[model samples]
Target: MSTPTTAPATDAASAETTAQAHGVELTEVAATKVRTLLEQEGRDDLRLRIAVQPGGCSGLIYQLYFDERELDGDAVRDFTGVEVVVDKMSAPYLDGATIDFADTIEKQGFTIDNPNAGSSCACGDSFS
Candidate 1:
């Protein structure tokens, strides 16, 4: 491990860097929520996978899906027992991303707090 010298949580772009352009932060709460969801679905082989794909309402779309397969250039980060794989192509754009789960009265879903996005679409399905 290098070092987590970035500032505490304030804005999303706290650790902006040119070398490791993209940064991601997976909250413990989110990891726990994922573990519970996997258990409920009886998918022991499933893991949360986050990726950035081109062509969306904006310039790019944030893709979050469950994956069981692993390929080359994939960065795997394990939290508790949950695994998150970021593909090589998407890693750069998603370097400083924060994965979180929210269960509120309004909307209950997983949210990706990415600082790389300069702008987001109206639907919130994609960003640039």
Candidate 2:
């Protein structure tokens, strides 16, 4: 049998505290959604990675996905059973950003509210 030594999953308050410390907030709804997705995948080694890449009409785009690799200078925060990771490069651009999931009749998807964005494209996919 393997040795058990990992820390327990953090609660919502701790998650929020971590979010404040990490500079990116992942809402409870989004965390729940991520947990569900991870449960479906049946792998506990994955972390939700968020990065800002140069592309799109506004010169920059956001990338969010499940990643099992841990790169250098990565800032990670755990919400319950889900972990959200942001690379050091993207941290400045995504500072104070709030990630949320909306399941409404009007719109259904993950949305990012970034305070660092000066202006965004018409399609709302990119920002300068």
Candidate 3:
């Protein structure tokens, strides 16, 4: 007779942890744009990092870029092939935020829809 061995955490559990890791969501359009940008650069070692810094008219500004370094307490989420990371210090301010891409004559770029933002600047680039 043999005893059954307990398995490690399942994919669902890991996914759940990932979902709760950061309340930020990356839209498919944003993910596709990031993947295309990475492909154009001929690199795959970078991640999309979103951060909140002190600046802008509203006193807080958003910083989004491609980063290769991973710091401690960074919350990471993978949107298909693209990875999105948010530092612990910025997590609270970014919770429930959505990242999306737009390519149009009126505007073209990555946009953040943050529910946590009480009021944003006229330029729509900063929040209080």
- Taking all chains together, the TM-score of candidate 1 against the true structure is 0.78
Indicate whether candidate 2 or candidate 3 has the larger TM-score. Answer: 3
Clashes of each: 9, 0, 0
lDDT of 2 by residue, 28-59 (tens): 99999988888898988999998999999999
- Candidate 3 lDDT score relative to the true structure: 0.92
How would you order the candidates by TM-score, starting with the best? 3, 2, 1
Error of 1 at 88 (Å): 0.1
TM-score per prediction, in order, is 0.78, 0.82, 0.85
Q: Give lDDT per model, in order.
A: 0.80, 0.88, 0.92
With a 3 Å backbone cut-off (N, CA, C), the pairs that clash in candidate 1 are 22-95, 22-96, 23-95, 23-96, 23-97, 24-95, 24-96, 24-97, 25-97
Task: Show model 3 residue runs off by greater than 4 Å.
Answer: 1-20
Clashes of 1: 9
Arranged by lDDT, best first: 3, 2, 1
lDDT per residue as tens, model 3, 48-85: 99999999999999999999998877889888989899
Residue 59 lDDT (model 2): 97
Give the worst 10-residue stretch by lDDT in candidate 3: 11-20
Comparing candidate 1 with candidate 2, which one achieves the higher TM-score? Answer: 2
lDDT of 1 by residue, 10-80 (tens): 54443323222335677898999988889889889987888988888788998888899876667777777
Q: Which RMSD values do the candidates have, in order?
A: 10.2, 7.5, 4.3
